[model samples]
Target: MWLLRPPGVYRPQPDTWLLVQALHDAGIPRGARVLDMCTGTGALAIAAAGVGAGHVTALDVSLRATLATRFNARVRGLPVRVERRDALTFRAARQFDVILANPPYVPSPQGDLPRSGPSRAWDAARDGRALLDPLCVNASGMLSSGGMLLIVHSAVCGVAPTVDLLHKVGLKAAVVARRTVPFGPVMNRRIPFLEEQGLITAGQRDEELVVIRGDRRDDQP
Candidate 1:
């Protein structure tokens, strides 16, 4: 898909594709209400719309990203609502049937997130769960009964924690898909830091990206 991304908006990469594939596999119900959190270029939102989602909402904190998504969806003539909001605090009157996220999971040396710039696309705190942890906790509340949340991130961030968090939040969570790819420029540059932090092996050059699914069972009240 051709998307119009400004300078600071994140370009879709392997992790993005992995989430898209997982979304496809999950199978969108016709007219499902879908939410794509941290939507950089609106790729997942567009995918949801293409798959027959009646209403798709894309959220990003970056103005550039929101504009790009708006333009991209408009060009495609897809019904997508773009909002500039932080995924951590975004609220909706009605819950969503599906939630998709490809948040910043790359472990960063800094303990805090960047206020602005391209690093916002991939830099999380030292543990790389800055966004992932919160998402695991809050996603269930955003999802309707029987809704599903699909999130993708590197295994370096500890996939088990994510699953456990989702489980603790009363959702059935598991890793549904995984793909190992060579480290990109960002990861490659952080090899030293990751090695020092013991997030990766001394010689490891590839990272495994996993798509985790958290399902809110129909039995839930």
Candidate 2:
């Protein structure tokens, strides 16, 4: 798409396209209320608007990202309300019919998440669950009855934990999509640390990304 992201905004990558494709395949309910968490350039938010959502709320903790998202949405003539807020701490007025997220999932050498810099775009705690854990748990409540949530993360972050967490919250959750990709530069640099953490084996250069889908069917287990 024609996205205009300034420096410091996270660009949509393969994981993003996969989630978009999943969104398309699943189809958005007409007049659906949608939320795009950790929205970088508003790619998914614009996509939802383009698909006829009643409302699209896109949010990011980074000011630059929120600005880029607004600019891109405006340039595309899509209706997306952009906000500068952390997804983990956002308190929406109401639950949404659909929620999309492509949060940071890359393992970093840092003991804690990066406070600032481009690293914030992809760095999580050592195990890469800093955001994923909260997201999976909090998203269950953020979703309305019969609503759906789709989030993408690397397998190194533990997809099983995500599914289990969502399930514990009474959302029917499972891995809906997965793709094996060669490690990018960030991942490549962390191979040794990842191996040391037993997340990967030595000489491993490939990683699998998975999208977890959760449905709040009236909180039925």
Candidate 3:
């Protein structure tokens, strides 16, 4: 799909496509409400709108991203509520039928998430769970009785932790999709630190991107 990306906004890469595919597999019931968290270029949001989400809310911390999402939705003739809100911090007005996120999971050398720059799109702290952890902990709180959450990230951040954390919170989480892709520029550059973090070995070059599904037990179909 064609998308408009402003300077410093994240370009849709393989991870984005994986999320889109997983969303497709999940299926959207007509009039189902959807939320796209950390919507970068609004690709997922637009697609959700296209798939018949009754109301789609796209939230991002970047103005450029929000504008890109709104613009894409407008050009596509879809109704999407684009907001410059930090998705992680907002209390949803109501639980959603489905929630999607493509958050920063790349392990960065820095101890803190970036304050600016393109790194903001893919940089989490050293452990790489800066965003993932919170998202898992809070997911059950914002989902409807039978809602589901889909998130994409690299295995380098430890997929088991994601599932384990979600399980702790009473959500049935599992890996549903996996793809091994050559390391992109960012991951290639972080190889040394990743090795130091014991996330990769000396000769590791391929990283597996995975889509994890978390659904309320009572709502599983």
lDDT of 1 by residue, 35-72 (tens): 99999999999999999999999999999999999999
Give the CA lDDT, 0 to 100, for residue 108 in model 1: 97
Global fold similarity of model 2 (TM-score): 0.97
lDDT of 1 at 166: 96
* RMSD (CA, angstroms), candidate 3: 1.7
Better of 2 and 3 by lDDT: 3
What's the CA error at residue 44 for candidate 1, in Å? 0.5
TM-scores for candidates 1 onward, in order = 0.98, 0.97, 0.97
Give per-model CA RMSD: 0.7, 1.3, 1.7
What is candidate 2's lDDT per residue for 174-220, written digit by digit as tens?
A: 88898999999888888889999999988889989898999999745
- How many clashing pairs in candidate 2? 0
lDDT of 2 at 31: 93
